[model samples]
Target: MKEHFKVTQRMKRGVRIAGLALAFTVCGAMAWPGGTSRLIRKADQAFELEDYKAALKLYASAVEAEPSSPEANYKLGITYVQLNMPKEARAALQRAIDLDAKVEQKLLLPLAEANHLEHNFSAAKAYYEQEKRSAPTLEKTYQELLRKRIAECQAGEDLMRLPAIYNVSNVGSAINSEYSDYVPVLMPDDKAMLFTTRRPDKGRKSLDANGAEQIRITRMQQGNWQESELFLETQQQMPQHAVVSVAPHGKELYTFFADKGLHVSYKLQSGDWTQPELLKAPFNQGSREPSLFVTDDGKFAFFSSDRTGGYGGLDLYVSYKKEDGSWSEALNLGPEVNTPYDEDAPFVDTATNTLYFSSRGHNTMGGYDIFRSSISNATWSKARNLGYPVNSAADDLYFTLSSDRSTAYISSDRPGGAGEKDIYRILFH
Candidate 1:
């Protein structure tokens, strides 16, 4: 094992191990058995059964028995990561990688995650990119995008605070409803506004699995927001939740799911919007927690996906928008704007050329805070929290412009709300 980064202090990590879920039986071998593999298997089983103390002891014994087995080392590394011992996990995982460069990239995925949790972005990035490059052909594309995000850290951005006196607000009953409404949009020319919401409609049937459908399109007219109206009913499906993300060229629209699902289409010459259809797999895995945005030229589409080899959780990514308007595989946003918790709900405004979204991994005051950053030539500045009143003790998510840019919209569960979560608007000076 190599000293990738000097261990400063003990690193704290989350306790979740996905692959170590199988039962380990001390199998009776045809001949004398119970070798190092068996011992490791037993230790892993003990971990699965919540017997941490027993698992630790068996792992130690396994290492003593077969001081050089990569499999044993990997298991040990993973256990340490679960227990928040980055120093031990790093040593163990590095040993596993050294022993066998051929292990499924799946193993590197966890190591990359552990490294990021330890705030060793450089090492985490190297591991993530290696995993992406070595992934099975079928998944390499997605993995590549995941790698980009893990390497996106920007130094100055993390430490700077948002400017004072834009006096952020949580638009009251005027815009929000008794449901989850987020992912706002500023209409062309900034006079009209558009946003996504879960406000109930007359007998709308597209209820999500949780029975709360996060839907789209709340408008503001004459200095007031009209109660939200569902967009393109023909494009909706039962038990599905959706949010419109980008509106390009005054007529084109981009949308993503609160859960997983993607719908894209354009308005036809007949004055009716085309029926929305599902984005294909690798791009639309009903399991991807997704977000979408398009560049000024519409040649590239920005999105977020968990995929594989990510630092952890969901990461922001991008894909090319083909001539036919179909989307390509995503590209990770890298270490600059992404972190281990999750980054999604991207709103890329080409006019002001600023990017805004919610992040849980950055220094947040609470659940999820809306962040803003400048976008310049395929690069993004560090994101700054929109702040205090606009960002509260709870989630202050999704930023929508009002009928005019003078006011903005958001959603939260803090203090006042019609239900568990409600929409609120903020006034922008």
Candidate 2:
């Protein structure tokens, strides 16, 4: 998936909307006799258009012009939330509450959301409770969302109490940039890696100009990763392609195309990739199949799809290669692995028969969290959360492990990342 997709998913799962009508009313209530009103109106317009970056700047100016205005501070805080800056959002939202107690009715849910993103679970639950009391007439759907959020906070608290003992670090500037860099796929030997990045085109001034997801490859030389280079072969194939998983032997690569289905490309003897071929029939039956992983022996393929007959949303499914080299009909991984919510980004460790994937359900602190299930006696075990450091209060996906299992890589949007989503290295301890 592209970086924009990740942001959209996060916004859908976490961010709350106050609606443009409420925003207009709030700005109008705080309208000054002069320039502040103009600024507020401009900020509201940007926010309404979903140009949050522009809205962020205008809202900041509004706050600077009126430090004690609850409306300005509240709008600024909401803009921060849209931008995924939880700490800044918490500060601005708290300021709004301090400026006027009445704003608490409008600000509590977003404040709780900010705290939830920061992993301050206890405070988030308190604010959620306060919001529930303040808004007794909230719509039934929204009330259910609040209940789910509170439960997630409890899950976060429980998970944080027994944090994973691992050192998680950014892969650094060699492969990461100010733009989204994620979906890391490592070679079997760990000497090279392939990942997708959403950076500006070579001659473009900024990502907004004409940015697109481009695959990049980096190789380890003398024990340090060399700077990445764009994988032009794959880039030339399509405007939108996501690196899914590399074949265990590194001879074949899997990718997803938006209009097409899952694809595979082979490494030629001369070291160049052949044009990718879309998987046929039963494999591409779904309207949307975002991920796939082939077993080391190449007998079984695991993927995720939202096609009919699924447990719900996107469910993990498996297909076995038939005698004629065609895939069998896809079968859901059963209710234990497929929830009513989405499950995606499957990565299988063939050696252990363990399936690692991200899901919107199952003990998630918030958003998607990585979970693993192993097959034993032909039954998939109940999925287990990978726990704190590897799984945060954000969408974590595309987990890949080194051959020795001492190290791993994952893409996440947790705080302190260089961009919306960055590939992180996890050193098991």
For model 1, residues 1-429, the per-residue Cα lDDT tens digits are 011111111111111232122101111111122344678768867875655556768887887787777667666777665554567777877886787665435466567656654545566677767765665462332443343335332221232244345665445565565555555666666544555555555455553322345445556578666665566666555445555554566566655654447766676778587656666644776447567766646676667777787766777877776677667766777777888767777766556877777776565543466788787786888877776566653455666553345766666655445544666656665
Q: Which ten residues in a row have the lowest lDDT in candidate 2?
A: 15-24
Error of 2 at 248 (Å): 4.9
lDDT for model 1, please. 0.58
lDDT per residue (tens digit) for residues 1-429 in model 2? 243344334333333443222333444465433335678779888887766777889989988988887778888888787566899998998898888877776767677778888999999899888876765774444465577778889999999999999998888889888777889998889999989887766642232422566688999999678899977554444655778888747788888766678888888889888788988866687568888888767788889888998877788999998999898988889977988778998888888889999998888898789999999999999999999988888788999998899989999888788877888999998
List the candidate 1 regions with Cα displacement exceeding 4 Å.
1-163, 189-210, 214-216, 257-260, 285-287, 323-326, 376-378, 401-405
Best by TM-score: 2
Q: Name the 10 consecutive residues with the lowest summed lDDT in model 1.
A: 4-13
* Residue 113 displacement in candidate 2 (angstroms): 1.1
What is the clash tally of candidate 2? Answer: 0
